[model samples]
Target: MSRSALKLRSWPLTILYYLLPFAALRPLARVGWRPTSRVAIYKSVPTRLLSRAWGRLNQVELPTWLRKPVYSLYIWTFGVNMKEAAVEDLHQYRNLSEFFRRKLKPQARPVCDSHCVISPADGKILHFGRVKNCEVEQVKGVTYSLESFLGPQTWTENLPISKTSFQDQLVTKEGNELYHCVIYLAPGDYHCFHSPTDWKVFHRRHFPGSLMSVNPGVARWIKELFCYNERVVLTGGWQHGFFSLTAVGATNVGSIRIYFDRDLQTNSPRYSKGSHNDMSYVTNNNQDGIVMRKGEQLGEFNLGSTIVLIFEAPKDFTFNLKAGQKIHFGEAVGSL
Candidate 1:
């Protein structure tokens, strides 16, 4: 399909997307909806087909005039704030994908403290706490194994003997010392993600999974939602120990790009070998590992998405966080 035809189809979706925030019945409407697993089974085929087509178009060259409006539609759909971005003019962007992942001004977001773990983006806190053993809370009274969250090999390779008996230690470690934080990026927020702490980008892994919506309602219903969604997991050792940040993909959001590693984009295939039909692989290790200072840009979602931060055992930090708190880039997430 031509770009014009795609824009026409996207118009109604854009209108309904804007109206959703103002609808008086928003809360009640979602009460009956399960955004996570509520996949439009029939629509999956066409959606995937369209996504593939768009993926191809994303690489196509176009004149400034045609690219500007297409890029604007993307920015509008995701509620991207141009003012916060380094580029003030929408037309300055050469293409839709460029605008979708625009960078912010250097001073727009400053790191909270040189010694603290700053929030990676302007987003709402979904949840933050310790990962006792191998289990982390998904929602109220619901917990998913960390082994499952990181995948079997990552669990085995990272944890060793503690793997089998990990989740059993949950109750003993429920304290303020260990921490995990979930950040949900709304369409209007900045999409670029930053490093929460100083670390070396030693390895990056992508897991293939579903493209369900990651709205709060969906997160509450989808067991292991973060683990199951298509995500790029960046792992590196910090002052304390190992730390990881996952950039999760959502419905209609096509790609997650990492700024530090070129291997993820150049060498790996876009799809994975699995039942989920998601993408997975580690970025290349050829280049010297990129070391990021706290609050440095790590990567970005092509559109609105979710980020989950995980700290390894023996966590020694404390975050002054509460459920449902709104966080911004460079805000204090926790102190070591």
Candidate 2:
């Protein structure tokens, strides 16, 4: 009887609403033009469910004879170098998940100790530089709120935060600056993420959102794409001041496994959107939190994802990386 109710009942409009994005993309596809961020039809598909299903599919063991052919196809498709894997034989991996979580030879990636911070994973650097106006650049020009990304500074009760500005609250010491680095893992890259520096992880925050693709192109098209996806934010302290590492989920990659936190689950069947879960690592052994040395294994993803590092450093800090440059897990990202 109501106008709003009548509109909701209109099947013609409902069909047009859902079909418009696809219809527009038909011509683009025919012309060989591909859009990276499917923003228009993003809500049309159930990406989270697909990712979880993919996670399960990864665990399904294949026939012994089918392993090599199946894995070889993936390796060729993604350009994965089998020589780097500790177990070079494809048969050693029982399932796709095993192959994904395969270990690399110890000597494969040598950590660069000369620098202050090393890359957490082997991927292309999306962006890195100083945080301005409490905002971090998702890509070249796209930005997201720093306060929103890492949540509140409630984990820093010891530090003076009451009277300081929002950005100033994160600076544990004077003359300190905030820096961030975004690393995007491809399907071919190693799945494990490591500690970029010697730090103590005090708290962990999990933000569950859509499981969208986080490749460079999508990041360029979608502002705050990282903020919109499910991400595990590990906040801690280093020699400089505040530090954090965020593991962002992506399409077909919903399972984010933190080696230390077994209780933390991601990409669940049912969850409330726009809500976050938090856990503190403070204990007798970790007065501040879990102590992690540089290059220590932190966690892993089922498939390629993204790692974001935000830390406090001196104004003299400089990045040794170029935007869009490929880097390995132990390579230096920045230094004094």
Candidate 3:
């Protein structure tokens, strides 16, 4: 079918989906088109069903002849270059996630070995700069609390703020300045994310919230896009300072699989049973924690999502990235 024809046929589903769900949230008349309000409606619907459907469809085993057309269409639409993927053949991927998380050959991306930090994923750098006064830039005229995004304030039951601040352990700077960076993965980009620096992850927090679209369109307009989404926060420290990597989820991106913590599961039905205000947490206080080298695989987004990194480095540290710059995994984006 022609692309235009395919697009035409898809509207009925969209129409049905939008109208039927309004009945569940009664008196939907109050909801406005404002991004956050719209997102409240978006999260109200059980989109996990759609996520399951997509997952099941991707995992279906297909005959070689049947696979070609599907794979070809995806490649053509996404502009995926087969040369960079570790398994170049389309038939090698059993499911879409396999293709999404395809590994790269060793030489395809060389890990930066200098006294620096690297890009953690292959995507566009949304924003990267200093974290000032516990706020980080989300977009122009938009910012979110760095501490709240990292979950110290939100995890009231699990973590308490005493005399010592969490940032104190990670950052040893003079002015209490911490660095922040956000990278967004699109549908066509590589889904796997890596560690930006050599660090030991001591704790992780999973905050369950609305699975709204993190696409630039929604993000630019939505308040606290990262803070409002379902996300997994990894907290740890490196030689110079403390860092936290937050993996934010989106609609239809049901799973955020952490290889290090196999027990971690996102978008689960239990969490969505009654409220989205629940949280899951884990800590490694007894042990030293999981040590990862720069460019090591941290986790993956089953579908495209966003990653937020907040850290405080020693003096003379600088990021080599600009807003909206497209970056590849293992490429150096900052130097100490």
lDDT of each: 0.63, 0.84, 0.71
Worst 10 residues of 2 by lDDT: 13-22
Candidate 1 CA-lDDT value? 0.63
Which portions of model 3 miss their true places by more than 4 Å?
1-40, 153-176, 272-286
Better model by TM-score: candidate 2 vs candidate 3 = 2
TM-score ranking, high to low: 2, 3, 1
Best by TM-score: 2
Candidates 1 and 3, the one with greater TM-score: 3
TM accuracy, model 2: 0.88
RMSD of each: 7.2, 9.9, 5.5
TM-score of each model, in listed order = 0.73, 0.88, 0.81
Residue by residue across 1-336, what tens digits does model 2's lDDT show?
678866554443222112222234446556666554346566456778878777788899998999999888677557689999999999889999999998999999999999989999999988999999989998899999888888777875666776456678888888999899999998889999999999999999998888877867667777788888899999889998889999999887889999999989999988888889889899777686889999999999888889999999999999999999999999999899
Residue pairs whose backbone atoms clash in candidate 2: none
